[model samples]
Target: MRFLLIEDNVQLASAIVERLSLDGHVVDLAPCLADARAHCATAEYDLILLDIMLPDGDGRTFLADHRGRENATPVIVLTARSEVSDRVGVLDLGADDYIVKPFDFSEFEARCRAVLRRKGGASGNRISRGDLKFDTLAGTLQVAGEQIQLRNRELRLFEIFINAPGQIFSKSKLVDRLFSYDEDVSENAIEVYVGRLRKHLSASAANIVTVRGLGYKLEV
Candidate 1:
């Protein structure tokens, strides 16, 4: 999944980006509300990890404005505030969950999964398409009782196709969903990933179908 991390602490953000990237997630870092807003204006994210105290403005205000505009993207507030009232206030402002600072990385990951599952994402970290089994947590595909592993972004691209099934995704859309803003992507990157994914799914009941002049879709 793609995530937008709105935070100011350079070290913490680096840790977060590294952790999430290791799990095959594309993460974009925004040190302030201005950069965060710019990201939101351009790309879509599966989740937003927002810090309440931002360099340019309060994240609570950003959350309020995001909701005021009817953007229902799930947000989990990452802050140092431990007060019950602070949690309630941010929840009232439209945060799906809250995590106090200095949190364990494992616990933080679990919290993110909890929030995403609550928001109808990857149902319990498992998805079954025909005879193909996907374990989101493991980032592996299981078929015929055999586990097939995928590279990071290839798995991400597969996630997109499985989520929408037959919907034809344009190359640009896949690029947006698979690569982060800071990553250097080539013109034919999607084609390369698609080819790689086809090879991985060779033994499975799933198929990645390409529509000439359009894009690609998943068939199971």
Candidate 2:
């Protein structure tokens, strides 16, 4: 998954980027609201991790403006405020969830996964399509009872297809999904990843099919 992490504390932001990266998520860090806004204008994201107290501005105002612009990207607020009112305030401001400070990384990741599941309309952490079991949080795929270990790029590529089974996803969208803003992508990156995923699923019930000049789709 691709995420925008809006945080001012350099240490905390680096830690978060590292943690999310271990799960195969590409995280872009923004230290202030201005940087956040700039990132939003240029690239799309699956989620946004926002810090309520930023260097330049309050994140609540940004949340209001974000919702005002009809940007439905799911946002999880990272706040030091632990009071009930504080939590409610962010939610009222359109944050999907809030994580208090002094929290463990496990709890943080769990909250992220939960919010993503709700927003994506996925069933629990395990999204099932026919005999295929896809766990977005763990970044693992299982066909019938066989577990297939996917590399990071292959996982990201498969993630896009699993989310929207049977629907065509254009190559341009796939490129955006597979690579981060700063990553260098070759012309055949998508095709190479698709071929790898196809080989992995050859004996399984799921398959990926190309729609001549249109895009690609996952079929079961």
Candidate 3:
């Protein structure tokens, strides 16, 4: 999954980004509200990890504005505020979940998965298409009950496609989703990953099909 982390705490943000990346999720960090808004305007994220006390403005304001625009992107407020009123305010503002500061990383990760599952209409960590199974939590792929190995980029590409099966994804969108802010990537890099992933999915019941001047979609 692709995520935007809006946290003013540089150390915390770095640690979270590293952990999420290790778990096979692409993450972009924003140290302030202005930067976060810029990221939101240009990119689509599966989730947003928002801190309440941003350098420029309260994260709640950003949440309100986002919901005001009728944007449905799931947001989990990560803040030092443990007050019931604070939590209620953000929840009423359409934040999907809330996490208090000095929390366990395991709990944080679990909450993230729960929110994503709820958003994707999935019940658990595994998402299936035909005979293929993707272990979202474990970052593994299985075809017909047999495990299939994929490179990091290939796995990331597969995750995006599998989660949104039958939906067309343009090359530009794919690039945005596959790479983080620091990576130097191009459209050709996306094509390379797709080509390799296609070969890996050869035995599966699902196939990735190009849409001819449009993009690619997963067919099952």
Candidate 4:
């Protein structure tokens, strides 16, 4: 999954980014509210890890503005404030979850998964379509009880498809999800990844189909 982490604490942000990247997530870091807003305006994220106390502005205000515009992207507030009112305030402002500072990484990961599952309408980390299974946590794909070997780009592309089975993804959207901000990748790169993924899934029960003028979607 792709995530935006809005935080100013270098140490904590680094640790979180490292851990999430190790778990096969593409994470973008924004040190302040201004940067976070800029990132949010440009790219779509599966989740947002927002710090309440930001260098430029309050994270709560950002959350309020996000919700005021009817954006439904899930957000998890990361803050040192553990007060009841603080938590309630952020939740009321449309945060899906809240994590206190100095919390366990395991718990943090679990919360992220839970929120993602809720957003994706999935019951668990394993997204299954027919005999094909994509394990979000393990970053593995299995077809008919056999594991399939895939490259990093192939795996990421498959993850996006498996997460939202029949939903059609435009080429531009897929490109955005596959590449990071700093990467100088073109839209054609998405086609290359999709072509490779199609070859890899040839023997599987699931397939990737093009939508002509639209883009691509997973067919099971």
Q: Estimate each model's TM-score.
A: 0.92, 0.93, 0.95, 0.92
lDDT of each: 0.89, 0.88, 0.89, 0.89
Cα lDDT tens digits, model 1, 1-220, are 8899999999999999999999888899999999999999999998999998887989999999999999989999998989999999999999999999999999999998888777655658888888788876788998768898887888888878877788998898888888877778974999999999888788887889989999999998
RMSD in Å for candidate 4, one decimal?
1.7
Q: Which is the winner by TM-score between candidate 2 and candidate 3?
A: 3
Kindly indicate the candidate among 3 and 4 with the higher TM-score.
3
Instruction: Show where candidate 3 strays beyond 4 Å.
Output: none
lDDT of each residue in 78-133, candidate 2, tens digit only: 99999999999999989998899867999999998888788778859888888788
Where is the poorest 10-residue window by lDDT in model 3? 148-157
Q: How close is candidate 4 to the true structure, as a TM-score?
A: 0.92
Model 3, residue pairs in steric clash:
none
- Backbone clashes for every candidate come to 0, 0, 0, 0
* Superior by TM-score: candidate 1 or candidate 2: 2
Clashes of 4: 0
